[model samples]
Each structure stands twice: as structure tokens, then as C-alpha cells.
Target: MQFETCHIPGLVIVTPKVFSDSRGFFFEAYNRKPFEEAGITANFVQDNQSQSSYGVIRGLHFQRNPFAQSKLVRVLQGTILDVGVDIREGSPTFGQHFSIELSAENKKQLFLPAGFAHGFSVLSETAIVAYKCDNYYSKESEGGIRYDDPELAIDWKIDPAKAIVSGKDLELPLLSESFANFTY
Candidate 1:
């Protein structure tokens, strides 16, 4: 496997070595040693999965400290435009965002450290997104920024009129209006 860090510190892209033939393909999805070598030492405690159709947007979400989660997300089927936004105060890339395409064909994965808000837009007819999180979810600690916040100016690649966002996500405050307490 090859682990590459993005411009934002602690965000990594993991590409597994796949051995494929006419039959199928095989690769190690997770291994403790290689991950530790790559500087990712989070002890994943929960796994979550979701399915969404084209135009569906889920997230721009994060948890406050003590309940902050580090996530390793991948597309199990179909494709999605994955996004991670840094909210860590005092960090060089704070408020900056990163976007990537994850698909079953490419088998790429993203590791988003704590202090980052995450979300994805489905690009295919349907997509299965799965992730491993280092911390358990806390409803009270849940917080997020609007997916279409202009200051961040994320291009979700889906038409605004076509976006299928949840009511709660639609109600999420914009970064400028947020009271998040993330730190560097």
C-alpha cells in the first residue's frame, strides 16, 4: 500500500496494491503495521456505512474535542466526490478544503484526522460509502457547516437545484456562524 499526505497536514490518501487477474482482485484493506509506518495510529473503534443516490450530499460534519473522530473513508461501490474541510484553529490550512473522487474501480481511501469536517456527494446512480472512525459518535458533540458555505466555496460538482440534502444538514450553521471549538 502507498500512503500519500495531502496539502493539509494529517489528511492522507491510501492506495492499496491490488493483485488482479481475469478472475478478480485482492488487496489488503487494513493492516496495523503499514498504517503505523505511514504515521496513522488511530485506534478505529466504529465502522459506519451509508448509501446515497446521485445528487445526494451528506455532511460537512465533525465532533468536538474529547469526541472528535478520525475517519478512514472509502467507496465500496459506485463513485462519490469526497470532501474534507479543516477547522483546526491556528493550523496553516484551517478552513481550507480538499476534494477527491473515490470509486470502486480505483479503490482509493481517505484518512481524515480529527479537527476536520467531512462530507461527500454521490456521483453515481447509487453509492455505498463506508468509513472507520476512531471515536464513538456523540449526538451532543455533533456539529457541521453548511455544504454550500460561500466562504469555503466548495464545488460539489452537482447542480445546486439538484442537490438532495437532509433537513438537518440544511439547518447546519455556516462556518462564519458556527461556534466550533476545534484547535490546532
Candidate 2:
């Protein structure tokens, strides 16, 4: 596997070396030793999966300290534009964001360390997204920034009129309002 760090410290992009033949293909999606050698040492504790159709957007989400999570995310069935934002206060890149195309064809994965916010936009007719997390979910600690915040200016690659979002996501605060207690 190959790992490349993003602009944010601790955030990474993982590309697996796939072995393909006329029959099919195989690759080590996760190997502890290689990951550790690549400088990723998070102890994944839970796995989660979700399916969404094109135009669906979910994210800019994170948990507060004591329940913050580090996530390794990938696509299983279709494609999506995965995004991660640096919400860690005091960091040089705070408020900055990174995005990548993840698809079953590419077999690429993204590591979003704690202190970051994550979300994605489904680009295919349907998409199955999977992820591993170092911490469990905590409802009380859940937080997020509005997906359309002008300060962040994320291009979700989908028309705003066609975008579908949950009521919870719609209720999220803007970046300025949400960063009051942020810390690295």
C-alpha cells in the first residue's frame, strides 16, 4: 500500500497496490505493519457503512474531545467526492479542506485523523461508503459545520438545487459559529 499525507498533519491518502488478472483482482486494503510503517497507528474500534444516491451529501461532521474519531474511509460500490476539513485550532491549516475522488475502480482510501471534520457527496447513481473509526459514536459530542458555509467554499461537484441533505445537517452551524471551542 502507498500512503501520502495531505496538507493537514496526520491526514492521509492510501492507495493499494492491486494485483489484477483476467479473473479478478486483489489487494491488501489494510495491513497493520505496513500502515504503521507509513506512520498511521490509529487503533480502529468500529466499522461503519452507508449507501447514498447521486446528489446526496452528508458531512462536515465531527465529535468533540473525549469522543473524537479518526476515520479510514473508502468506496465500495460506486463513487463519491470525499472531503475532510482541518478544524484543529492553532494548526497552520485550520479551516482548510481537502477532497478526493474515491471509487470501487480506484480502490483508494482516505485517513481523516481526529481533529478534522468529514463528509462526502455521492457522484454515482448509487454509492456504498465504508469506513473504520478509532472511536465509537457519541451523540452528545456530535458537531458539524454547515456544508454551504461561504468561508469554507467547498465545491461538492453537484448542483445545489439537486443536493439532498438531512435535517440534522441543515441545522449545523456555520464555520465561524462552530469553531468557538476548537483546539488542536
TM-score of 1: 0.98
**Position 54, candidate 1: lDDT:** 96
Candidate 1 residues lying further than 4 Å off, grouped into runs, are none
Worst 10 residues of 1 by lDDT: 175-184
lDDT value for candidate 2?
A: 0.93
Which candidate tops lDDT?
A: 1
148 Cα displacement, candidate 2 (Å): 0.5
Tell me, by TM-score, which candidate is best: 1
User: Tens digit of lDDT per residue, candidate 1, span 7-99?
Assistant: 999899999999999999999988889999999999999999999999999989999978999999998999999999999888899889999
Report the lDDT tens digits of candidate 2 across residue range 49-164: 99999999998899988889999999999999999999988889999999999999999999998998999999999999999999999998899999998999999999999999
TM-score of each: 0.98, 0.97
- Which portions of model 2 miss their true places by more than 4 Å? 179-182
Supply every candidate's count of residue pairs whose N, Cα or C atoms clash at under 3 angstroms.
0, 0
After the best TM-score superposition of candidate 1, give how far the Cα of residue 48 lies from its true spot, in angstroms.
0.3
